[model samples]
Target: MGVRPPQNDDDEPDTITFGIAALDAHLERADVEFPVDAETLLTQLGDPDIPYDATGSTVALSEAMDKVHIQHFDSEQELLNTLHPVFESYRERAGNSILGQLRALLPF
Candidate 1:
């Protein structure tokens, strides 16, 4: 049988990996302080009550970006270009859960 989907969104473990290398590189280039280190950032993102909410249960893209001081962008496209991959990676690694579904439905 193929892989089964999560029965309860809450039951699904949060296993999303933040592409730390890329994130660090980007932050370094931008001369921005990484609000939280890779490990802490991942832990915070896994929590469902850290202020940012996307599906009412996960960290919002804007919130995460803002945490790292990523407020200004040349354009909407530029912002998306910079962060889409990271969000996508989070969803992909997070697996089939309500959070992932919410991420898919909501615009980052």
Candidate 2:
């Protein structure tokens, strides 16, 4: 085997990190410059799969970007701040999905 992600004691299958945590991959890309326009950011990011909630399900970065009203971001911080609530809305919606309701029945 090659390198592995650090494991959690709870033994979850995926290390589901959301919000700014999920943007690590996008932010690290050299092609993405700050003060970027929303459309350009979406295109450059290539619509990454961002972990949306505790269930480890995901929504595309493009999906979140679509709901963002801001035309441009002066810095990564601005982008993150704007998307934070957008991600939360997706999380809330996902939590209300049938599968999420089914998961709620689980004792774990």
Provide the overall lDDT of each model, using Cα atoms, as 2-decimal numbers. Answer: 0.43, 0.75
Error of 2 at 73 (Å): 0.2
If scored against the real structure, what TM-score would every candidate get? 0.31, 0.73
Spell out the clash pairs found in candidate 1: none
Off by over 4 Å in 1: 1-57, 66-71, 96-108
Model 2 spans > 4 angstroms off: 1-14
CA shift of 47, model 1, Å: 16
lDDT of 2 by residue, 42-96 (tens): 7888878888666667788877787877889999889888988888888788779
